[model samples]
Target chain A: MPPLKSAATPVASVLAADARHTVTVVLNGTPRTGQAHPRLLLSDFLRHELGAHGTRVGCEHGVCGACTVRIDGVAQRACLTLAVQADGRRIDTVEGLSQSNQGPTEGRMTALQEAFRRHHALQCGFCTAGILMSLSDYLGRNPKPTEEELRDMLSGHLCRCTGYAGIVRAVMDVTGQAAACDTRSGEAAHV
Target chain B: MKPASFDYLRPATVADALAALAAGGDDARVIAGGQSLMPMLNMRLVQPRLLIDLSRLEELRTLKADSGWLSVGAAVTQAELLSRPTLRDEVPLLAAALPWVGHFQTRNRGTVCGSVAHADPSAEMPLCLVATGGAVVLRNAKRRRTVAAADFFVGPLTTVKAADEIVESVRFPLAAAGSGHAFREVSMRHGDFAITACAATVDGTQASLAVGGVADRPTLRSWPLVGGALLSDLDAALNAFAWDLGGDDDQHATARYRRDLVRRIGRTVLEEALSCRR
Candidate 1:
């Protein structure tokens, strides 16, 4: 662990006033140091500062999972987290999920992406990034999560248009390595 | 929404944190994990002049069990506490209650001490602490003292935590063999704050029950194990307990309804605890 550094000086006196706090975080794979306000939401830092706009912010409060991202490999709502709280931590946005491919696979979409396309999981696509990010983290832990577990894990996310049938199919398809029906479970598949 | 303007101070040590709190006086708010404080700030419910961020103060974020007592740092996050193997083994009631707290996302950022300080009557941690005979350690610039859980809470969202004092840690008595614990609550959703909550601890022939959400503060009751009509006695005691505490009606439920639910849930939890002992 790195030595915790004290603030250089009192930057400002007010809450809305921008006060600078040094935050050293690993965005994607590279370590970056920056000054941010105490009020700067982590989602804004990723979208505006680092230009990783893939991390969406639907509901600024914690109710919506649209701004979900991996902080130290744990799925969290970035909008509800302060930039300063993420100091000296590893953060993985949707951008980090794609970097695993190399050579001929460089810049290629991930297995999850391919599964989403094959299962037609997205419609309007507004909630795809967060849903994918949360599911990626969830599946990483429970690759073979039961149908009930999948439903429970996805409960945090909201998809206004798709009705969640397609998304559930996409997740099941990816995890089951099946094209359709997700035959692993005898329950009738929605999509 | 942006938080109201305030001076920020990240103290590296507990002494420094306490000194900063004393210096800032009543206008200072100590923030740990910032899970609850940040939301309150964004909503402008509290606009303190100075924020004593205790995140860097690692000494105040630990969990240790010894000599039949479990000591927990006030800054320890709900996630951290729930994940600790010792807490899981020794204090499973806390572990069971933690998952019902504000979902995984908030739990990752919310601290155990912060929840206790916030004192949301609907929250799980405070009621668990109260049921386990927990004591909060308070440190001010000059002195330190411990407040028993029963006396710590004064009313809804209020506590005896003084303005100049910071909660350093909380200690809970470890449950002995033949002691069983149970917690249950009802909410609109899994992650939503509880509408009514109850925690019960049964140690041999003695029982301690703490009810939250339906009261201004957690209402507690103690009694010896009765020989006959266990459910009826528990229900009658819970009803009397709620009436004695003067529980009021809120948007969630009527005062009568809350008292009824308390009786129902309290009896259920007590029964569960009793069964676990067998």
Candidate 2:
């Protein structure tokens, strides 16, 4: 790969305005230090500063779960957390499940990902990472979740696609529980 | 949207936090879970000059079950309280209300006292605090005082907290033996803020009723426990009910509908609590 040619020259004042806080964090097992504005959001810091673009942000007011990430092994809303608040802490974003390992499947695609694939749980792929991260933290504590309980767990996420059928099935299949229904919605069923 | 530039101060002690607040004057805000405050900051609704993070104040992180009450420190997260069996036992109203605070993730970082201090009129913790007759412990450099939850909130998102004072903890008195607690709320979505909610604790012939989202702050009423109140003319009671919190039309619900819902949930929770006592 070669660097793309660009005619735009970089400006310095914008960079100067952002040099307010020196935040150090352990992100996905790596120690990184950078300068950010005191109010830079954790989601923006991950995407812009560390280039972890997999951590998506949809609703910034903390309603949608698209900006979910793990901090100290706890799933949290990146949009609701400030970068300086994350200083001296550990964070895990969707980049942790990126294709980093040599395998037939997506690199670092944990069991939940495989289950999602098996059930055709995702379509637009926008909320996939956040949902996976949210459930990864949730399922660790609730391995034998019931269908009603799993639906309650999934309520935290807002999916405009799939109608949540496959997502529920994937969770049930992974947990060896029975699905409550067989109907799929909107997107063509791939499974 | 991101927050505006501000200094972040992680104070080592409550005293230091108070000093920072005093020095920073009216432009300083405290951050605990940052769940509520961070959202406000992101919306650019609030821009403080300094943020006093109370995450490291060990003295404010205590959760002790005393003889007749439970005191939760300012730094204790909502999830922490939900995880404690004793809180679920002694202050059962809090346990019933904690899950409704927000999603599991928000609860993981949102502080119990912070929620009370943030003072959302429709929030579950404030309703519980008021319904159960809880108290918010306030402290400044000069003195410390405890204010009842009923007297704490001046209006929506407003409280009696001064510039130099910090909400150290919230104390919830234990429910009487054989008392039954019930919580009910109607929201568009499962984890969203309530349209109207009710909390009640009934013991024998006594009952405490508190309703939120129908008023500016949680509207509370205490009276003798009436048998078969759920089966009685709930509509009549709600029709004549005064929403002291000042109900008004909003995007989520109409003022008339909110008042109607208050009566419905109020009757349901009060009846359920009474039945449980039996």
Candidate 3:
């Protein structure tokens, strides 16, 4: 039998005594890797370490959906996750959604953005990023959710100012006119 | 608040993880998704010297069905379980109970094994597993053993899992065709922790009930089927168990209030389960 390896590595010693660790993650269509502490929260790493501030943090306890991001193509809360946990994984923040200058190109946010603008979905703007990420993820799985399904899906998110009426309208408008949106480029973006 | 510093190790195998835990001694902790553990760490409730990451172990991420049982790996995330088509048909109770575990975001990283290992009395996974008579497989460097759900939980936030052992998987027996399972909980908010949770499963003449959150460990009661008259007996049994188990008072609800709620919820869940058979 092979000799048994030592399993007694102390996490405190590693974390407290400054043992450097590196993690690789694909963020926003680009492969990015960095060195970080094991205790580093993914939300903090994105906003402070990597300067990707589009992923906002609200009610870090996982109640509010303001810290939502896509991890491995599924919407996840960044604030509640450790950066090291996302190592070797694919992550997409709100910044990956669309480009202002891209002009409805592939994977662009033309229709959803237009719907939000048309329905006045956002107010205060603090909760927009998280809502957008969640909505985008939902629409990808269910392109045409009924009003009840949309309401249930949006239950995880909070929009204190808009009261969800505008957001629901925006989702319905975008989904109801999905064919027209599909004719344009970037409407087929999943995850 | 910043989490207290801790060493991180991503072990490629379960043996390595167990060795790391043994070596780190009491200061070493196993972390899967860090969804629950991270919050506890941030709150300064636990400060382990080492964090053994189990994410690298591919063996712990599988969901397999055998002849009589379906086994779910410890590191299998809630999102994975929710999406797995097998679980929907094999264990409908788990499927129904999972969405209430947290939210889509938390579920993305939270693992079923991690939740069960944490042994939060009010947690959905533990209650559902116990109700279904699930078995937990714990492995160490030298040996591995399986503990039944009835014997796994010893107290709140505590289990039979040894410090040097890692939870490998949980096995749930497949329900018979006429079987039915139901889970319900009452919480202050939609996504908050449950003040009281109940799960019941009925298969023909046999019935099993497991109640969590209102007790230190999941309280389970099983008996042969009887008609409406037996409900009062079950309610009495629950009321007596509630007082006997010391589930009456906590930050969420008073001891007296909890006892009342448990009796009410237990009867309701049992009645619901019985109705499905007829």
Candidate 4:
């Protein structure tokens, strides 16, 4: 084992602890600017500073997927990201999903969202925004994913209600796969 | 949970980052992907006086395979590594273990070297590193050094890394011809930390098994099959190794159950590796 060095050497200047930095990001197809303390998370920055409430914050840690959003077109946890880290980046939240390329129609829901409504994928709706953001990004890349792959992707999120069966059906329907639903029995169909 | 106030710096180059570390010493912390560190920060587990962000440093994003090793740079995310076309061929153990590191959402942001820097007991990255006989590159303002993965981790969430140093990259030995590797873990949830993880690498002459989440650090034991060993001897060696790991009863599993996993999953991975060998 190499000898562990102690922290005795001294060198240069550091930013003040209370200093706030100006962060600018292209959020939801618009340039948004805000001032944030270095300690502020991107989740809070989006919700409080930028007024993008579609990106919810849950489990301030990375466990719950409610804070998941698209950074540079890739889905990632906003809670795990710092506001300054997302400076000068493009961020797409659930609000932007409705505005995506859906044949030139404004405020039109994506196929995934329509399926979610048809299959009753959301209840209480606390985790819906994050799940929609993740799935919308995912189903775009992997348009036709196996049930196992979709389930593996869904494992990242935690939803108290719905038991994830409706979410599975919704995704299956959007991907052009036949999904059986038994609403009368209130039982989850085999995914 | 919210993180305590701290000064944040995004250095454009590694030199500036090292300078910031040298100045702040232990009070400054380097953050790459922040998958593990952010949770700690939000929970106030680690509140540094300064936070240095390395996401913008382009030089630290190298991921290349050469010289019989797949060298992953500090800024290489787990998703980036998994997306590498040659990852499965160059480093099969890592390719097998990367999916189990975190969920797809977190993996999109979690760096490969960041996991090694965190050095969690049940983390799949360190276990794969030790199992494949890899190395970790450490850099500071003044010097650079390489340490074997087996010697890099001393305990859970603890490594030989110094306060003024950063993990420059990690090098995983490429899979040799006629060699095969496999990884398996038993976690409470799909994206949760493993209760017990097993990784195995085998070739014509030697068979090695590494187990994590059951000890202070990932431990590896090898058996030589040059002339061929008896089945009973192999079983006895595995059983002894499982006991030696000293599984602790935790919220997720009992000590006995962990040991059982070590013995069972350990053998299952070894058998899978042996059968996959070309």
Which model scores highest in lDDT? 4
**Which wins on DockQ, candidate 2 or candidate 3?**
3
- Judged by DockQ cut-offs, the docking class of candidate 4 is acceptable
- Tell me how each candidate scores on DockQ against the true complex: 0.32, 0.28, 0.32, 0.44
> What is candidate 1's lDDT per residue for A1-191, written digit by digit as tens?
33223233222233333567667778777787777777678988888777889998886777778888888777888877777767777888888777868788888889888767666677788788888888777787678877776776677777888777767777777787444564444244587
User: lDDT at B109 for candidate 3?
Assistant: 79
- Kindly list the interface RMSD, in angstroms, of each predicted candidate in the order they appear: 4.3, 7.6, 4.2, 4.0
Which one is best on TM-score? Answer: 4
After superposing candidate 1 on the true structure, give the runs of residues whose Cα lies further than 4 Å from its correct spot: A1-22, A119-121, A177-191, B228-232
Query: Model 2, range B114-231, lDDT digits (tens) per residue?
Result: 9999889889999998998899999987789999998998888999999888899999998777888999899988888999889988876666679888778887876664562443
Locate the minimum summed-lDDT window of 10 residues in model 3 chain A.
Answer: A1-10
When 2 and 4 are scored with DockQ, the better candidate is 4
* Candidate that would win on DockQ: 4
What digit string (tens of lDDT, one per residue) describes model 4 on residues B1-278? 99999998777679999998999988899999999999999999999999998876788999998898899999999999998989888988888898898999999999989999999999999999999999999999999999999999999899999999999999999999999789999998898999999999998788899999999999999988655332447667888998999989988999899988988898889888988886
Chain A TM value for model 4: 0.84
The DockQ of predicted model 3 stands at: 0.32
For the record, the alpha-carbon RMSD of candidate 4 to the native fold, in angstroms, is 5.8
lDDT of 1 by residue, B1-278 (tens): 76767777666678877877888888888888776777777778888887777865668877899788888887787878877877766887887688788866677677888888889888888898889988898889899999999899988778999999878888888878778888898887677778888898888677777888877787788888866225445667777887776667777677888777777888888888777763
